[model samples]
Structure formats: C-alpha cells, structure tokens
Target: MTEFRVLIVDDDFHVARVHSTYVDAIPGFTALSPVGTAALALQAVHALRPDLVLLDLYLPDTPGLELLRSLDLDTIMLTAAADPESVRAALRRGALGYLIKPFAADGLETVLRGYARYRRLLETPGTLDQAGLDRARRALLGAREPNALGRTRSGTETAVLETLASGGLLSAAEVAALVGVSRATAQRYLAALADEGSVEIQLRYGATGRPEHRYGLRD
Candidate 1:
C-alpha cells in the first residue's frame, strides 16, 4: 500500500511532536518532520510533496490563512482559533477540515481517516454517478454513521476480530492484510474495538524510532 504522507505545521514544537506521533500511529499514514513557520512550510511543501498538511492559524512569520491561500496542497487547519470569521475564512480558502487544538487523538484520527476515504473515492477510475459523488462528498465532510461502542459490528469489523482471535498480537497493517482491507480501514476498526475494551494494545519498543502498536483480543 502507498503510504499517505502528512506535514504538520505548528509553531509549538511540543504540539507538532504530538500531532506527528498521532499521524504515525495511524496505519497507512506517515508524518514528515514538522515546520514552525510559513516560509519553512512553503519550502517543505516544495521539497517533500506531502499528501496532506495539518496547519495552524497563527505563525510568527505569517498568518496561517495567508499561507493557506498560497498553498495548493490539501490542508486541514489544526489550531486554537475558534472565531467564526477564522473558521469561515478557512472554509472559504478550501481547507479540507478544521480541528480545534487540545483535541483528543481520536478527533484527529477521524478527520485523517475521512480524508483518506475521500481521496480513495475520488481518485478511482471512471466518472462518478450521483450516489458515488454523494458518497465522496460525505467522506470529505467527515460524516460518519454512529456506531454504538462495539455493541454492533459490521462484517469487516467482525472479520478483524476473528483475525485477531487466530493470529495473536498483530499490527494494524498485518490485520489489514489478513482481512483484505486497507491499512487505514483496519486501524479504524481496531481503534474502535480498543476503545470498547474488546481488544488490547501492546507497545513494542525497538532499538530506534517510536514503539510499534500491536493489538490482540483482550483476555
């Protein structure tokens, strides 16, 4: 599977690291080194060519909205700016999503997964019919049907559970390969299951880099 690259643009080093960790934790997505200024962001975009950018509204060098207008790449505003005008300006400038700061990991994950689905839907071959077009639009809008905390499961979700039952501990990518779904899709389901206490996550430390997350049925 082709990895989706993400660039995190926040002036705060701590916040940027947190966002980068969240992006890396999700399957099928990788985070590039974050930039702290609009100028650096511009240079990074030109050099790295990331698939999506998590942007902040305020920067020391330039306003993020100004930077947004300058960027042709896909972006989602991740900032503390909650003013209606800022929100409207961001939407008007073609930001894919806007996330208020101090948000939980799940909130960012939801948007990232939705964006992934949106891209997949629209990037497919052939012209889209009305229904297909609507689906793509909804995905872009991050419209998700409420699932009642593992009370009910889709066929794919059940397959993921069964795969874990047999395979012992496995990473999201491994589960995806076993269940015949995208890594992002598998990670979404696994996250939901983990949230409901149906599954447990183990962090495996390596000699270098971040720890790997492996999931299994909770005993």
Candidate 2:
C-alpha cells in the first residue's frame, strides 16, 4: 500500500504536535514537522510536497481560508471555525473534507482512509463501473450513513456497539473484559467500527512504547 505524507498546519504548537501524533498512529499515513504559520506551511508544501494538509482556520500570519485558496494542494480543514461562511468557503475552495477541531483520532482517521480509498480508485488502470465511480466520488467528498456492524459474525458485533454506546472510552482490553471476548477479538471489532465510521479511535501517547488506542462511539 502507498503511504500518504501529511503536513499539519496549525498556530498552536502543542495542537500541531497532537495532530501530528494522531496522523502517525494511523496506518498508511505519516506526517512531517508541523508548521505554525501560513508562510511556513507554503514553504513546507513547496519543499516536501506532502500528499495532504491538515489545515486550521486561524493562523498568526493570515486567515487559514485565504491560505487554502492560495494553495493548489489537497487539504482537510481541521479547525475550530464552524460558522456557515467558513463551511461554505471551505467547500468552495475545494477542501477534501471538513473536520471540526477537538475531534477524536478516529474522526480524522476515517477521513484519511476515505481519501486514500478515493485516490486508489482514481489511480486504478481502467474505466470504472457505475458502482466504482459512485464509491470513489463518495470516498473523497462524503458518504451516507455507514453500514452497521450487525451483519458481522454472530451477535458479538451488537454487543460491541452496545458497549461503546453505553458511554465513556474503552480500550480493546477493557471492552473485551466487559463484552466477554478476547482482547484481540475486541480490537478487531473496534477497528471495524472505525472503518465503518461508527466509532472513533484515539491514541493515548505514553512516555514510552507505542500509543494505546481508545475507542469511542462517533456522534
């Protein structure tokens, strides 16, 4: 699988680090050092040419939307600005996706994954069928409600969703303990939910070792 490079743009250093961390945790994706200003962002894009940019709406040097219009690269608006005009401008400026700030890692992951899928479809060698074309279009833009996990093997998927819906975040191990499944089994179901956009997975970075994944139901 092709690994997509990401450049994170945000004014807050710590927030940029957090978003960078989130990007790194996801499979098939990697992020470079985050840039704090629009000028640095443009410089990084010229230098590195990342596959995508996680852009924030506010910057010390300029409005993020203006910067978005200036750039000729793909972007996902990761911002606290949720006003109608911001949304309209982002869409008009060709943002691949719009994600409000303070989102779980899974929320971003879902968008990235969908983008990757869309890219793959476009890169495919032949003409696309109607279903293929529709799927690819939705992958980049957006999708209708995802198919539920109820169709999985046995009734365990239902149990997993119920556990997640009950409130609070859960690690695979914790969910397994609650739902009477092995940790690995729990993790698989949680990943399925993340892929389906039914739940969001967050990474809890520790001082040592890899980060841990925490699962939460999507809003």
lDDT of each: 0.85, 0.84
Q: RMSD of model 2, in Å? A: 7.5
Q: How many backbone clashes does every candidate have?
A: 0, 0
Q: Which runs of model 2 end up more than 4 angstroms from their true locations?
A: 141-219
Pairs of residues at least 3 apart in sequence or in different chains that clash in candidate 2 = none
lDDT of 1 by residue, 72-169 (tens): 98999999999999999999998989999889988897787678767766776799898767766776776643453335778999999999999578
Model 2, residue 212: what's the lDDT?
78
> Best candidate, TM-score-wise?
1
lDDT of 2: 0.84
- Candidate 1 off by > 4 Å: 145-219
Best by lDDT: 1
TM-score, structure 2 vs. true: 0.65
Model 1 per-residue lDDT at 192: 62
